[model samples]
Target: MSRKLSPSRVTSPASASVEPSTPRATRTGRRVLAGVVTSGVCLCLATVPASAADVPPVVSRGVTIPAFYTPPAELPAANGALVRTEPMSLGLAIPGLDGRPMPGTATRLMYRSTDSAGQPVAVTGTYIEPSAAWTKSGPRPLVAVASGTMGQGDQCAPSLALEHPLTLTGDTVSVGYEALAVYRILATGAAVVLTDYVGLGATDRLHTYANRLDQGHALLDAARAARKVPGASVTAASPTGLYGYSQGGGAAASAAELQPGYAPDVPVVGTYAGAPPADLTSTMKGIDGSALAGALAWSVSGFAQADPDLRAVVEANINDTGKAALKDASTMCVGDALLGYGFTKSSKWTVSGKSVAEVIAADPAAQQALDKQRIGNLTPAGPVRVATGVHDDIVPHAQARQLAVDWCRKGANVTYEPVILPNLGDKILTNHLVPLITDQGNAIDWLSDRLSGKPAVSDCWSMPLQP
Candidate 1:
C-alpha cells in the first residue's frame, strides 16, 4: 500500500485536536485511520462454532480513522504526563466482505506524556501477546518498542496506527515484524509497545526520514501512554527498559537524550542502542546512495521535518513531482507506499530518489536534506548502553563509531561494545541498520535487569577508529 513520496516541510514539530468522530474513550481502542471491515471473519473457528445455519457469523465493521496526528488537548507539564490514545487494526489476508471477519483486530492503546515540548501526539503501536498462549507468568512487563525507519514522509507506511501491517503478521514475511523482539520480551511476561512515530499510520504527513526529536518523543511518549493501557499492567513507574535497533536505536538514543529535558520523570532505567546510525551526513555519505539508496527518502524527510528551513530549501529546487512526493510521503502508510496497493510492484513506485537527492545535494536545498540527518544530537541524561557489529554496511560501522566518539566526547555516559558480526550479521535484521546497535545480547536479561531496578552500565572506550 506504499505510495510515491518525496520530502519537504518543517516546523521543529508540534500538534492539536477537534471533537473526534468517536468518543475519546472507546472499548476496542481508537485508531486515527478509517478501516473497512467485513463480517463473518471467522476470527477463530474454535471460538465461533457453526450456527444452525451451518455457517459462522462474524462482524466486520469498517474501522474508523481516528486522527491524522493525535495531540492531547492538554499536554503534560515539563514534569507532568502526556497521554496519546492509539487506535489499532490487525492484518487481513482477505479484504472484508459481507459478514466476513477481517484478518486483523481493532484495538487502542494509551501512551503517556513523553514529549520535550509537552505536545500530546498520539503515538502508534501494536500489541505483542505470547505466541504460546500460557505456560504461566503472573503478568508481563509492557515492552515499549521504538522501531527503525521505513523512510521519511507520510507516504511511507506510517507508525501512528497501533496496528501496523508488519506487526500483525505472525509469519516471517512481515518486513517490520519485530514479533521476535515482541515475543522474546513478552515471553518474559511483558507486553510490547511498538510505536509508529508521530505522523504515520493515520492520514498525517509521513515523517519517514530520520528526525531524532520525533523519534525520541514518539518513543518516550509511547512508554508513558503504554503505562495507562488497560490490562497492560505497566505503569509510568514500572521498572522500564528500552530496546531500539537502527533508527529505533537512534530514537532510543534520542529518547535517552531527551530524558533529562523531556520525560526525565519516566523511569527509563536501562536501554540498548544497537546498530544505530548516530549521525546523518556520515550515514548518507557512507551509504553512497547505493541499494541502501532508500536512505535518500529518509534523508529528505528528516531534513524537512527537523526544522522549517529545510522545507523552504527544498521548495526552491524540487520539481513538482519532488515536492508532491515529499509531502505525500510524510502521510502515507506502508501498505500504500511499499506494498503497492496490490496494483503494481513496490519497485514500480518511488517514494524518493537520486533525482531529488541529487537536486538537493548538488544545491544547498538538497544539502538541507543531508544536513538534517539525525546525527550529532547525543547527550544522554541517563545511563546508556550501545552495541554494534564490526562489519555493518548500511548505517556503516564508521557512523556508529562516530556516534560513540561524539557522545563520549560529550560525556554522554555511554556504554559502547562492538560485536564481531558477520556479513549482514544478525538475521540481516529486518531494518538494515541493526548491526550498528550495541544492545543485542540477552535482550530479556538486560531489560529485566533494568525493570528489576538495576541501573544501566556506563562503560566507554576510546572511539574505535572508523573504517
Candidate 2:
C-alpha cells in the first residue's frame, strides 16, 4: 500500500518543442497526457492483492506467484515451452497517456530459459492476440516487446502493469508508457508477447536488471512461447521481430545476438532498439550524477545478483547509505526512483567519497562484471535499427554511435538514426526522452518493413555524429 508503482513520442521533423518526459501540463494545470489511444471498450479487471494468502501458489521447486503465475513441476526440458496459459483482455488507460481499451486475448506461459548462471530457469510472460486482422504483407507477424525500465519489484512487471494501470511502487506509478508502444505495435495487426523478465514477475528472486544473458533469454523464449499459445494463430514459421527501448532495447539487442546460437528455431527477422544502454560501463559513468542516478544502483544490484565476486566487492565497499539506497531500489519501479532519487550524486551513497563509477573502476572484479553486461559485442543474426537522440545525456549519444561502429565492424548490417533535436541546456528530460518519442513511429515502421520480408537498406559505414 505504501509503495507499489513504476512507470514516448516522436516529435515532428519541422519543430522541436520543449521536451517533456511525460505530456506537458495544460493551461488548466493538468498533467501531460501520453498521446496513444483508439476507440474500444474498457474491460479492466481487479488484480489480486499482494497478501500472504493471495501470494501466487508454488507449483515447482523454485517457481511461484499468483495462481495464474504457477509453473508445472514437470517442466519441459526445451526452452520456450508453454507451461500454462489463460485468456485475458488489455485495457489501456494511463494518467498522462490518452489510451483506450485494446480488447485482446492474453495467454500466460511458463517456459524454460537460462538465468544469469546459464542454468535452466522457468520464466513466465503473456502472449496477446489482438482482435485486429493482419492486413500487412506476408503472414501476420509476432512482436516480442521488452519494456523500458519498469522497476526491480514484482509489482512493476509489464504484464501486471498492462493489467492494472494503477500499479505503483512508492510515489511513482507504472503509467504504462510502454503500453503505448505495445498498442502501437498491436495497431499493426500483429500479435504481441510481453516478457516479465526472469525474476521481476516470474519468481521471488531479485530480477537481474540489465543482465544481458537473462534479459536476452527471457526475450527470445517469449517469442518461442508465443508460438505455442493456442488461438494466437502464429506458427513457428511466423516472421518474428523484437521491439524495445532503453532496458528493453538492450534485451532486444542481446536476443538478436544470442538467437543464432541459443534459440535457432525462432526465426527473428528484425529488431528495433531505441536508446539502448549497450555499454553499461560508459552508461554508468554517464548517469552517475544525473536524474536517473537510481539506475546505477539498480545496475549494481543486478550485477550482484549474477556475480558473487562483484557481490563481495559491493558489500565490502558500499557504505550504509549505499546499502539502504540499493535495498530501496530493489522494490521501486522507475517512477518511484525518478521521484525519490532524481539528480542525487552516487558519491553520497558510497564510503570511499567517490562516485559509484569511480568505485567500480577502482576494482577489477567490479569492472569485469559491469563489462560483461555490455551488448553489441556479437553480431546480430538479423537486420537491426538502433535509434538514439543526438542530445540525449542519460544513455550517452557517443556510446550509441559507438554501438553502430562496433556492429558494423563485425559485419552485422545496421541502420543508425541519430534523432536531431534542439539543444536545451540543462533540460535532461527533453534531450534524453524526446528522441524516444520522436523516433518510435519510425522504428516501428522500419521493423514492420523487415517483418514483411522487405530488405533493409542500411548506411552501414560508420560516420562521426555532429556535436
Candidate 3:
C-alpha cells in the first residue's frame, strides 16, 4: 500500500497512474493492470466541486484538514450511529457523460464506533454511490474498503484522498492508492465505503494504526453509517463485502471475524484480505529493518494509545531517539516515512539496543497488548479469500498463509491464494507490493460471486496438502 514515489512522478492530480509491473503476467493480469491504470488516470483528472471551496478548513498536526473531519465533543451511546455528513467531491469526472461524475456521488461522514476499550469514538469515512447499474442478483450491494497502511497522520486519511488523490506538502506525501480498488468496485455498480479507521481523520486523537478492534469496528460501522446516508441507494438488505490489503487486509479480516458479534445487522457476504498482518508479533519482526520500518513506530505508538500498561512499558524502555521517531512518524504519511525512515533499524531507538520486537518479547505487558492484536483466534463468519505474495517479506507471506490455515481449522469457508512470483528484491517493497496488483482481479471476482448469491466452495480440505 505504501509506494516509494518521487514528487516528479506525481506532478499533478491527473498524473498519478496505477502502473505496477506484474512479474508472471497472464492475460487476466494484463487486463487487471490495464483496467486499474485506466481507472486511476481517469479519476486523477477529477476536478473538485465548487462546494468544496465553501467548506471550512481545520488543522491537524500543522496540516490543514477539511472542516467536515472535525468531530463534536460528545458521541452517541450506540455504536455505528451517524454524527454528521457533507457532500464530497471526487477528483475524476467525465464531461460529456450526463455531467455527473464518473464512478459515483461522494459523501464525507462521521459516525460512532467503539474503541478497543468499548468507548464510543467518532470515526470518519467516505461513501460513494456508484452510477453504474447492478447486473448481479441482489439490490446494489455495499463493499466496505479498509485501506492499507496510509500512515499515522490525520492528513494521511483516505477520506481526504478522495478530493486530492496525491498530495505533496512540505515533507509530507500522501497518496490515495485505495481509490483504484474503490473505483473498480464502483464500476460493478456496487456502493463503496472507505473508513479512515479511528483517528486518522478525526482531530481528537492520533491515528491508532493497526489496532484490530478499532479498525474492524470502524469498517463495520461504516457500512451501518453508509446505509443512513440520506440519498444512498444501499439499504439494510444490501449485501456487504470487505476488501483490503496489507494493513487493510488485517482490518478486513478482523471485520469478518468480528461481524457476527460486533455488527450483526450488517450482512457481510465475503471478504478479500490480501497479505493481512495476522500475527502482529511476526509482522513487527518482518518490518523492522525493511523499507517501511516506520510502521514499527506506528504500531508502538498505537498500542501505547490503547493500553496504559503498554504505554508505561514504552515510556520506560524507549530512549530519546525512539521518542523523536515516534513523534515524527505520528505526523507523517506513507511517502514521508518511506523517504525519511526506510530500512532504518528499530534497535537504534531503544535504550537496551534491542529491536522493538526483542523488547516486546522481554516484557510481558507489551507482549499481552500485541497478543490482543492478532487476527486468527476467531473464525470469520462468511466466505473469505486470503491472498498473499509468496515473496513478500515486509508483512511476510508465512503469517498471512497461516491466517487462512487457522480459519480453515475453525471450519470457516476460506480460499487461500499464494501469489507465486520470483523475489523482486529484499527489503525494497517490490516483492510486497506486486501481488496486490497481480492478484487483485481474482480477489474482486471472488467477492463479486459472493455478492451474487453464489455459494463459496472452501478449499480448507486441500489447505493442509499445499504450502
Candidate 4:
C-alpha cells in the first residue's frame, strides 16, 4: 500500500502509462472510488472488521466458517496441467451491521503455489483457457500479474471497484490494478495470472515495498500453480510476457530481474513496467507535503510490516498518538486517508524526535536498516520496458528517471521510455500517478508486444533528475 511509484507524469514511446495494481481492494489506485464525485482520485473500498478475530479461513458463503487457518499441509506441486474446478470457499462478512460494515465471502477459483516459507498459498484470479470449451486459438499465451494494494486482511476490507458504493454509474466491478491488467493481457491471447500478493486475499504480514525478489517469486509461483487447474500443465516455460504499473510495475521489474536466478526455469521474455517507484527515498520526499499523505501513511505502515527495522524506526519516532495512528494507518484505505488523516494531516507526523520522523532522524541504527529496503541496485535477466509520467506528482518524474538511470547504469537491458502527460496539469504534484488512469494504455500495449517477442526500443543514456 505504501508502494506507489508516485511518478508525477510520464509515458513510454513503446507504450503510454496504465495502472494494474490497487489495494486495489481499496487503496492502491489512490482513488477512494472511481466515481466522478470527488475532484481528485480516492483509494477505493477497504475491509474493516467488527473485531480483530476476523481471521477465520474458508468462510464459504452461506455456510459455517470452514476452520481457523492452520497452514495447509503442503502447497500442491505446480508442475502439472491446468484445469478449473469449483471455486474454493471463502467467508467475507458477518451479517450484522452493528456499526461494522461486512464484506461478503464467496468461493473463488485459485491457482496454488508455494512461497519462501514453503507454505501452501493460492491466488483467486480470472482467465480464459483456449483449451476449455472456450477456445478459438491453440495454446493461449500466459499473463501472470501481481496486484498492487488491497488492505492487508482477508475477512475485512473495502469493496472492490465495481462493487464499491462509489460506483460512478457503472455496473462493472472496479477491477483492481492486477485484475484490470489481467483482462488486457488476456485480450492479447494470453491466460493471465493475478497474484493478490501476500497478506491480501491470503497469507499474512507481507506486502513487500517494491521488493523485486518477492514480487518475482510470487508471480512465477503463480505460473506453476496455474497447472493445478483442472486441465492445465505448463510443462515447459512458454514465451511469457509481463506488465504492471505502480506497485505492479515494481513487481514486473522485480520478476523480470529475478527470473534468471529465482525462477530460472520460468521462461520470461519481455517485461513492461509503467510508473514504477524504482527509487524509494525519492518517492518518499515527493509525497511528504501532499494530500497524498494517505498514500504515504499506508506505504509507511506496509513498509514497516515488511522491514521490522523501519517499523521500529517509525515506532521510536512517533508519540503514543502517532503510534496508535500508525497502527490504525495500516488499516486505513484511501477514503479514510482524508482531510485530516490522523497524524499525517497534522504537522507532527512530518516533524522529528518528538514524532515518528524524529525517531527515524535520531536513530543511528536506522541508517543500516534503511539501506536494506532500498531497491534499484539490481539488474533484470531480460529486456525490460519502463515508463513514467513526466507530470506525475505522486511518483515524481525525477524519481522514476533516477530509477531508470540507476538500473541502466547497473547493466540491466532497460527499454527506458519517457513521455509527458499533457492533460495532467502541473499544479497538484500527485496527479502524475493518476495519468495511469487516463493516459496509460500505451504502456499496456507495449508489454503485450514485448511478451509477443516483439523487439523493444531501449536507450541507456543518463538523464539528470531535478533538485
Predicted structure with the largest lDDT when compared to the true one = 3
lDDT of 3 by residue, 303-380 (tens): 775676666667677777877677667667899899989999999988999998999889887798888889999989
Query: Model 1, residue 89: displacement in angstroms?
Result: 7.1
Q: Could you give candidate 2's per-residue lDDT for residues 195-274 as a string of tens digits?
A: 98976675434567889899999999999989888877899889999998888988999999999999889899999988
Return the TM-score for each candidate structure: 0.64, 0.82, 0.87, 0.68
Ranking by lDDT: 3, 2, 4, 1
Model 4: per-residue lDDT, tens digit, 302-379?
A: 555445456555544544554445544444444344434522442465335343333554666665555554556677
The whole-model lDDT of each prediction reads: 0.47, 0.71, 0.80, 0.48
Better of 2 and 3 by lDDT: 3
Poorest stretch of ten by lDDT in candidate 3: 24-33
The TM-score, computed over Cα atoms with residue i paired to residue i, of candidate 1 is: 0.64
Model 4 / residue 23 / CA error / Å = 21
Model 4: residues with Cα > 4 Å off, grouped in runs: 1-139, 153-179, 206-212, 232-235, 338-347, 350-364, 423-430, 461-467
- In candidate 3, stretches whose alpha carbon ends up further than 4 angstroms from where it belongs are 1-62
Candidate 2 lDDT score at position 2: 12
lDDT-wise, the better of 2 and 4 is: 2
